[model samples]
Target: MSKIDPKDIQKRMDRISEIFSDIVSHAETVSKTRCPYRNRHDHCTAEFRCRNQQAAETEEAPLVCGHEGEFDYRSAWESNPLLHARATKKLDEIGKAAAKRRADARRKKTD
Candidate 1:
């Protein structure tokens, strides 16, 4: 096999890095206004509620995204029943863990 040139390898690596950097930068800019749940076809793919979600024309179709990428997408993630339940479950786990820690500390103090 022919010996690999280090300069050629370095140049290729730099080009690859530049390509990735541009892609990442564009994605970041798009993310600021575009909802992460919105698909390329402008459909809401999230299982949770979002303020910008509009019902599809037909029942069989997925929900359409009403967002035009003009506003912050963070606030659009409205709470749904499933999301609320998930949050409640996480809180319960945290509370239980804290209570166990406290009980263990008390037992150590007494012993």
Candidate 2:
């Protein structure tokens, strides 16, 4: 394999960090509201509890899923049709931005 350039690696890492930051920011917003899946009993009825509960409690931004176990926030979000659309839309935007940055980097490297 060809040796990876340190500068290129750093740029990629920075872009990844930015992407993660954007995800966390969006998660923070989503966490502020009660999860659509939350039942009358205040328990998550789906595969897992709403991640917002955990995100509210912690200083560190929690991923879509607050639990480390079998379920993840993305799954929980996707369980509800409304949430699934919103989450996927936002994530897709972020993913596209990241992909564009990667493509730009590759083009610059080839030039």
Candidate 3:
């Protein structure tokens, strides 16, 4: 095998880093105003609620993304950690309760 130059490796890595930096910068800017959970079909796929989510005409259909992408959506999302602390706390509690039940079941089986 031919010996590889360290300079060549560094140059390729630098190019890749530059390209990814540009892509990440664009994504960050776009994500500020766009809802990531909105699919290409303009349907809301998020499990949590958002002010920008609108019910579909038919109950069975997925919720539609009502956001026009004109404003930052973080303020309108209930999934924001600061705004939904209680829900997060409750989920943690539920997880602990489920773990306890599982442990109790294992103990009963061992007995």
Q: Estimate each model's TM-score.
A: 0.69, 0.34, 0.63
User: How do the residues 1-111 of candidate 3 rate in per-residue lDDT, one tens digit apiece?
Assistant: 999999999999999999999999999998888888889899998768888999899999999999988888777887654556677789999999999999999999999
Q: Scored by CA lDDT, what does every candidate get? A: 0.89, 0.63, 0.89
Give each prediction's root-mean-square deviation over alpha carbons.
8.8, 21.9, 6.4
lDDT tens string, model 2, 7-31?
Answer: 9999999999999999999977766
Residue-by-residue lDDT tens digits, candidate 1, 1-111: 999999999999999999999999999998898887888899998877888899999999999999888889768786765777798899999999999999999999999
Q: What TM-score does structure 3 among the candidates reach?
A: 0.63
List runs of model 3 lying over 4 Å from the truth. 78-111
